[model samples]
Target chain A: MNETLAGWLQILALVGALALSFRPLGDYLAHVLTCPRHWRVERLVYRVGGVRGDADQPWPAYLRGLLAFSAVSVLFLYAFQRLQNHLLLSVGTKPVAPDLAFNTAASFVTNTNWQSYSGESAMGHLVQMAGLAVQNFVSAAVGIAVVAALIRGFTRKKTDRVGNFWVDLTRIVLRVLLPISFVMAIVLVAGGTIQNFHGIQSITTIAGDHQSITGGPVASQEAIKELGTNGGGFYNANSTHPFENPNPFTNWLEIYLLLVIGFSLPRTFGRMVGDNRQGYAIVAVMGLVWAASVAIVTANELHSVSSSAGHAAGGMMEGKEQRFGIWASALFAVSTTLTSCGAVNSFHDSYTPGGGGMTIFNMMLGEIAPGGTGSGLYGILILAIVTVFVAGLMVGRTPEYLGKKLGAREMKFASLYILTTPGLVLVGAGLAMALPGERAAMLNSGQHGFSEVLYAFTSAANNNGSAFAGLSANTAWYNTALGLVMILGRFLPMVFVLALSGSLARQQPVPVTAGTLPTHRPQFVGLLTGVLLIVVGLTYFPALALGPLAEGLR
Target chain B: MAGSLTRLLRHHLAALRMLLVFTVITGIAYPLVVTGIAQAVFPHQANGSLVKDGGGPVASSLIGQRFNLPSQKGQPSGSPDPKWFQPRPSAAGPAGYDPKSSGASNLGPNNAGLVKAVRDRRTAVAAFDRVPPSSVPPDALTASGSGLDPDISPAYAYEQVNRVAKARSLDPAAVRKLVAEHVQGRTLGFLGQGRVNVIVLNHDLAALKRR
Candidate 1:
């Protein structure tokens, strides 16, 4: 088959598969979060934790549950890394350093697996399984929990409570992430992804060369790594590593897994809001942006005038696996960034200037093109709230969204949610540029170097863990700075989400009036998307102009 | 005030206990169960698909290994043996093809350093393959995303067919046929590129007796 046709077919296949799962998976998610009855395992878990299964938390208490669980998770993961030398299956490696430990701990806990140290070497088997993998489950669940609380705000009336945080957390892990990951892991293993507990094995090659082979329980991690949109790799090469993503089949499956939860959450939103089209509207916006970015990126890649035959031969094949080619690689890059999953089958740093710009722009859209696991639904919902507010201002009326009045309190939280990441990214990157110590991590000089700094903060603050990979970011300054950025970027937006939910919950839902903007229509989707693009474009334009935009112009 | 403080403490404790319980289920059980099933089902694949020659394991088919002859008295280590088909260029680690230290060079497109390196690589590969610099596939000139990529594009595989045939005094048609036979299509219809596994193709080449 022709390569471009093949590429388009792959994209079509992806869309077809996602469209198939959109309603079922979304409705299942809504059911999992809202259903009152618990499984035996869940009941036992709640009993062990000394929390009543039926108990609910208002937004404040829900926020408290999230904070407390996350704080302990950080401490545990940090300790796990520090004590890797003492742990069995340390694989002859010593403990991780304090700063990297802090960074990795915060990174995983925030669902941003921004790995500094290479996985196969720096982390032992026990830590990869027990610490990092565990966070993939809970961090994603926590995101789901927060979004569930926000959904509860819409579903309930005259209530202080959103939902039981502990109950939501347990149910999501057991009923949602665990079972899916179990089947997916075995499927990956069947598809030639390696799964073993053995440490690095020394082997002789056919050419009489001594080579040490590294293999681990990669299939297990690879499952959640995509399914939960947690992009940490078992190998340093990430999904590009044939061990983690062996064949084209697994590659497509992995991409599907990355998007399933994020995309389907809109259906969950629609079902909860008593309007499936509202969900469809948001998804339509997400799909348009995602497809457009992928097309732009793929075309730029194939149109690589970088060399004469760059067009006839495949597009800029640098930093891409021949197995994936240009089309799949471009699709994966746009998809990974669109969600918070940072696993790349091809290196983004090696992408053409336009391709690179589109990717960073996707992240700058705050990854709400069906964002991360639970995070995506909430992120877009928050944006929806902001979008309605903007529309209302234009029409000179009070903003009402999903039959709930967006009052001053709700607007304040929405404003804070929208503004937080850009503030963190720009200010953080700006400081890194100005500071002498932090400036040393720039491997590329001039404009590209500035790109590394901007990409780091945009990636970290937005919790998208993919790197330009050009940045030497494991240094004390970069690690600590990014670590701080990851924690605040994640939890602070979360705080606003919960608070906004509570405020919305407190307001008696307004009946739909003729004056109210119909949210499920194309006009509304266009408005929400425009609001998203303009907000991100306006906020990050100068920094972008300095980095990717300038590089492309040159 | 005291009641509230106690309530907060209880909440924190419950949170900790929940984290620990869920950790065992997700962290421990899930991985262990998956690993057990994989081992029971496909032990060979679970242990890194070690391809054997004449009943002895040689190398993993998944990881790319350098096919250079052992270092001569004064020659550097990485000179091609010419008896075997070469895989794609790799910038994996110090002295390349170290599976233990697998990763890309991570050079961005706009970086001058990457441009210079690509230029150098293009010149070198074109010289080796007896082709002009412009004719070399980007996969041939630039490093693969995984430095340990086991396969090369079919175009790259075909480029080296004449040289391999000449070095071994074999028919060019036979080598070309070998490359053609080994070129695998995208899986289950479409997913990745149509790629030639260098190791497996070469293993088949080694089995073909020289003229």
Candidate 2:
């Protein structure tokens, strides 16, 4: 079969699988988040944490709980990294440096998973499983909880209460993420990902040379890393590693896993908002952008063709795994970036300039073309609000969506939420470029080097953790800068989201009328997608032109 | 200060408890359960897919290792041995193909260093394979994302048939037949590309007595 045909077939298969799982999974998520009774494990978790699962809190209290939980999570993860040498299964490596430790803790807790340290050499099995993987589950749960609260803000009226943070957190982790990850992990291990606990063991190669083999609980972590949209790898190779993602089958499964929860959450939103088509409309916007990225990237990769002259043979295949080839690599690149799950089956850095640009563009769109797990649904909804607000301005009517008015107060929050990531990203990139120390962190010179700084900031500030990799980012300069960016980028938008949700929750639903804009319609989907492209496109166009566009054109 | 610290301590305590409980659940129970089920279902695969060679198990068929002549003075290892079908070029670690140091070259397409490296690699690989530079598959010239790609492109595997036949003093047709035999098709019909497992292919070559 033609490689292009095969790529599309695989994509069709992904869409088919996602279609089958979408509604049930989305409905189940809505059920899990809003379910009255807690499961035994959830009850125990809440009890041990000294929180009540049945109770509801106002938005302020909800935000406070979230902040407190995140604050504690950061402190604990930081301390955990520092104490690695003293930990039993650290393989006798010393504690991590203070700066890197802080950065990693911030990364994982924020669901960014921006790994500086190579997993096998720098971290022990204990830290990989207990510290990083645990955060994968919980941090994802936090995103889901925040989204659920925001959804409730739309569904309820005349009440400040959104949902209880503790209840939502425990339930999503216990019922949704944990169970699914368990099955996915088993499936991955069946496909030959290692599940053993043996530390680094020396193996002799066929050449009679000694090679050190690092083994850990890889399958378990690999499952959640994708399922939770956390992209850190057990080995530095990430999903491309044979042990983590052995075959093409597992490769497709990983892309699907990264997308399943994120894409399906639109249906969750629709169900919660009492309109399945509303969810479909939102998903339509996401699916269109996502498919376009995949198409554009795959074509860019394939255009140079398979066989050519010596230097022409480049066909832009520098950092891709051969097993996946160009087509699957392009598909995986688009999928990983479309969500914040930065796991790569092939390195994004080596893609054709056009291909790499699409991946960068995917992140620049706030990853809301079905974004990170819970975050995607909420992010798109906020964008929908803005789209509606802008559309309302043209029509000269006060905008109401899902029956709630988008007044000045709501628009203010939406504007801030939209602006926050770009603000952080551009300023951070500018600051890094200005710093003399920052130039040393770049391994490439000129435009490509400038791109590395831009990509790092874009990845971090969007809470997408995949780096351009050519950037030498483990230093205090990149680490501290990106770490601060990740934290602010993650929480600041979240704050705006919750605040908007609070205001919306207090509004009584406006009755439907002729002028209501009918957000679930096809025209609305078009408007949303247009708003998305224009908003993200204009905001980052100059930076993008300077980086990927410049390179691709050259 | 004391009051706030107490409040903070209480919050910290909840976090500690949260981390501990989740560590037990995620790190311990979750992994244990998955491992148990995986082992019960596919014991060989669950235990790293260690393929048996001769008497004892050799390496995993899924993981590509370097087939190199021993290191010479002042030089690193990972020079490809012409006897074996080489997998993708690995930049995983300091020496390359270090299981403990798995990663890519991480080079962007437009970087001058990358353009030079690709040119250098294409020249070296084409010469080494005794093929026209244009005939060599791109996978042969590029570093895999995970320096541990166990398979090479079907084109890459076919490119090695003549060389392997010459090195083993066998018919080129016979070597080509073996390469054809080992080429695994895309999974479940259409998922990934057609590829050749270099490790398994190399093991079969090791069976042929040297000329």
Candidate 3:
């Protein structure tokens, strides 16, 4: 318990730092997107892009700009990845495989860092440092910026434009994410995380045998990867590696970094909306849900006994770092899965039945247990809207969130955004289960085997890239299927969210009256929580039964 | 109403100016600063927590350790010998438990073939350690989904200690003590069970015997 407590303290410190940093960035983004017309610097940027600073855009124009930016980012990131090997050849390095290129580009843009290739062996220092790491920061910033725009749309009284993409992206990366990541990275280095570019070394082991050790500049990438909720590891072992995590302190630090940015974003959102309690309400609900999942996962993982009675006596110790132990690893696992961050300190496959179940459940919640930067906030917003809708239904009045009436169009957009991923995940998993080629890839059969398929779709659909590491998902079938799912899973919701924002932006802001239910009130919070559970539960119950839950009974 | 709203927008626009200015400074400046600190302070870890030995880099400290073969009659096999530490039963054929190809056997417990395989493994472990079949742990006989497991049950480690200690001509008690030393309690003292690291203990065995 001391270890868990210590880990929480470290996590709290990082969260505190992140919360303080989010304000200036959030306020700045809120300002730029809400009123880009008056800013001289923003005007120059708009002029360069041939965008009219004063012209307010309707839904179509807003959607076009959003898609254009996303498309450009994907193409640029893809080209960057493809050309990296050649670029690094001047530094005496070679290119990564074509398949890996696709996987990596998709991974970063979607905020999922599912690496089919090992970082140390496959990527040169330059690509690792410049290309991949840079995307980790920017991709998350993009998510935050989009969410900021959506928030602006919700708050605007009578506006057609959502916000400026460039400006929002810039402020998010510059003010909010970068500063917190920098301080956190420094603290991590102080805690013994490495940051260099020396070649691999061979050392004589204590056993009088030769062993080779690999090292490189990791702390910089790792900091933002976690802070931004991007889960790609500098090494394949991820947080499990002794060098990456090193000691208990470092273990706590890594997990803290993974969660702080994700946790504090709600607070930042609340501040931007001029209602701190709204942020606290969102945080409270998310934090409680996340905490409950962590507790369940940790307890199950720590206390599970294998079927082989002799092996089951101790807690879940398999595929975990001894230095960090089961509690810290379990906490890290649940937290990472809850957010879109996939940095893992232990193998998810080796987690106890319940632990693994909770992880999948968190992902199934659309990764909105605080979620990815832009996506998580937007996801919560959808839930908030749903909560108001349900409450209004109960009271026999029309629902209103931030004074905007919950209507057919808004609900449809929210419903589609919420439902699309589960549909993709289930259909994808179902296809894999039905196909012999896909089924043949299963390394374990029955419940555990089912878990591999479930985990793949869940990870891909949620854009949370950490895997069970027990499935042979690098196959052509998995690669293609998962890649498609990731692309669709990410963009579908985004498009719908942008649409929702556009629709909401056009609605005239209504004044709050006696009949208006305060969204931050306890009753509304309950409704919101219930809405999230029901929506997720309805979408994933059958799949859950077939995977982790059914597997637990066995 | 329109004029007042315009005035309000203009007032907020001033605040927006400060927001944009601060945003650029905080967003770009902060990440650059963090990356710089991380790069300057911990070069190796900053790059990626990779560990290198005498022959340049071998593998990451964060990844699973793979031990492929039995030591030659006199050559050292390093810690966590495959022979004594119940191998993380592999799903990767030919090259067992490869990190690059992580996976489980995907064989359900109900499969007649899987049952047969497990029984065969039980017999083999029992025969190899000269122990009862009942004494062999399931983790010993079964393959983990990911072949790259670094730790095993204390029972699994203990099951091999007698055989390994006999082979090395070391006292069983000393070997057991070493295993105990390598044992890690569950996280938070209550979250997980006690288990021993197969590789670290085996490495210690080799070192202790050498000295």
Candidate 4:
């Protein structure tokens, strides 16, 4: 309990610091991604690329451009990975295994870095930096661009074009992401996070024995990895690595970095849509939900481990980093689960039954509590729209959100995007459970074991990428199945959302009148929250009952 | 209407072209550039953080190595080597810590089977450490979820200090101090519990014996 109290104080302080820093950072990002002030460096980049930043394409055109960009990106990334082993053979690395390559490619492309292979062993320096790290930035940038486009749909009146995809992508990377990454990388380096290319060093231990130290330019990838909410690590242990996370300060920084960008984006959304209130409302909804979920998950994790059936006389201390304590680790678990980030300091599989259930439930809800960059905001908006629709049905009036009427077209797109991942998750889990080969992979039978498999598919299919890791998902069947899920989970929803954006762009923005439902009000917030839970609950309740809840009872 | 539709399509086609161009540049090109920088800056780490043999490349920095194997062939009669620190108990297969099938035995506390397993494990630890069964740490008897845990609880390490020291004919106090030094405290003085790296400590003990 003492440790828990101290942990909360530390986490609250980190959260407060992050809150203060967010506004300026958010303003800067909004300006960089949307404002058209050209620095000298920007001019040089444009000149070198022979790119003109002048084109203002309409909404349909924007969609086409985004699609084309993504297609080419996929091709280029795939090719780079395929050729990486040969090109990087000078560095003593071979081509990645075809299956692993396929999995890695899909994982990064979809903003899901669900790694079945060790990063340091399987990948070359060039591949890690160019193929994987680059996607970390671009994938997040794409998400931001999509969210920006969606906001344009909400705010625009009698407009066909949302915004230029090229401009938005450029602004997101150059103006917003790059600067923050630069500062954060330096800060991480200062905190003893290694940023070098030196060979692994063999240092004599404090006990007078030699042990090899693994070193890399981790600070560079680490900053974006956290900020983008992508949880792949330079080491297999992810944030648990001493060089990567280093100390308590570094761990706190990583948590803040993961959350700050996500928190600020809603405010950015508000500014973009010309409605600060709307942004605040979204933030309020997201924050409340995130806080409640984190609280429940953390309390369960601590309590479950502490209780320990009285057999373990000590506190909840197994498979945990002692430096971080239970509260910090518990908080980290909820934070990582809430966002799509999968960096873990403690093993979630070791958590008590109830605690583990809360974690799976968070993932099953699609990590929409300040989710991955653009995806979280947009995902929540779908819920918001659904809430408005339900409310409208109750009142016998047409539903509207942020001045846009909830029409059939919007509803269809939102429903499809929202439903796709759960379908993949539930179906994948069902198939895995029913099949003998998959069942044989389970180390533990019944509820807790079932939860592990369910958690993996749910994480992969949602592009959340965190896993129980207890399941033997590195096999050929799992590799293919989970890989496919990651791709479809990410892109299918994105494609639909883009199409929805295009549709919404063509329609005139409806004015808010007496009959309009106020989304920012408390009642609507409750409705929005209920709508999110109901949709997730209905879609995933059966699977949940079979996995975590059942495991808890047993 | 057809003419207007075509015009709209054409307009979007150009936008799509721009979008494709930008996506490729940022998505593909940017990743390549960053990867190149990382490689050039940190070559060893850029390579898969592989830990090599005395001669050259062998295993990885991230993967756990196997230790504490039984000396006999299909004989469940002999005890494990006291000199080598053991990893957390695993239920993977005939032998524990099998990467091919990684997992924990999901046994509830109240289950009779679980109680028997725990009691049996406690008896083994008590014999190994020459201490009361109650003194042995829970982390020692319990199987970690991943089963590939490279670390052990500090108390678990401390409990085994006497046996390891006795086996190697070293000072027990020195060994206990070494274990204490190796113990990593909670994250931020509050995140998780303290633990010791069994592999690292054992390796050190071996080096000390050689010295």
Best by DockQ: 1
Each model's interface RMSD (Å)?
2.2, 2.7, 7.7, 6.9
lDDT of each: 0.87, 0.85, 0.68, 0.69
Ranked candidates, highest TM-score first: 1, 2, 4, 3
Candidates, DockQ: 0.66, 0.60, 0.13, 0.15
lDDT of 4 by residue, A352-444 (tens): 666667777777777777788888888888788888889999989988887777789989998898889988998998899889998777655
Q: What is the lDDT of residue B2 in candidate 3?
A: 100
Q: Candidate 3 lDDT, tens digit per residue, A5-106?
A: 655554455456656755655455455445534546545644444444465556565555555554554555566666775663223345655666776777
User: After superposing candidate 3, which stretches have Cα over 4 Å from the reference?
Assistant: A1-65, A89-94, A305-313, B1-70, B73-211
For candidate 1, give the lDDT of residue B166: 89
Candidate 1 or 2, higher lDDT? 1
User: What is the per-residue lDDT of model 2 for residues A1-554, given as tens digits with 9 covering 90 to 100?
Assistant: 77667778999999999999999999999898777877787778877877666879898878888888888889888988899988878886678899999999999999999988888878887788888899999899999999999999999999999999888887888889998998888888888888887777666666555666667889999999999999988877888888899998899999999999998898899999999999999999999999999889888887742212214555656777766778788888998898999998888776777787788889999998789988888899999999999999999999989999999999999999999999998999898888888877887677767888898999999888997888889998788888999999999988999999999999999899988899989999999999999999899999998887877676
Docking class of 1: medium
Best candidate, lDDT: 1
Output the better candidate (1/4) by lDDT.
1
Q: Write model 3 residue lDDT over B13-105, tens digit each, in one string.
A: 433343233334443344456557666665555554444445554444433354534467865443344345555465533345444344444
Best by TM-score: 1
- Where is model 4 more than 4 Å wrong at Cα? A43-52, A89-92, A198-213, A305-319, B1-124, B138-211
- Model 1 lDDT per residue over A1-554, tens place: 77767888899999999999998899999899877788998889988887777878788988998999999899999999999999888898889999999999999999999989899889999999989999999999999999988988988888899988889989899999999999999999888899999887877778777778887889999999999888999988899898998888899999999999999999998898888998899899889889889889988888883432244334587778878888989999999999999999988877777888788899999998878998988988888998998999999999998889988888999999988999999999999999887887877777777888888899999899999887889999889999999999999999999998888788788899999999999999899889988988899899999987887787
Deviation in Å, model 1, residue A207 alpha carbon: 1.2
Let me know the DockQ for model 4.
0.15
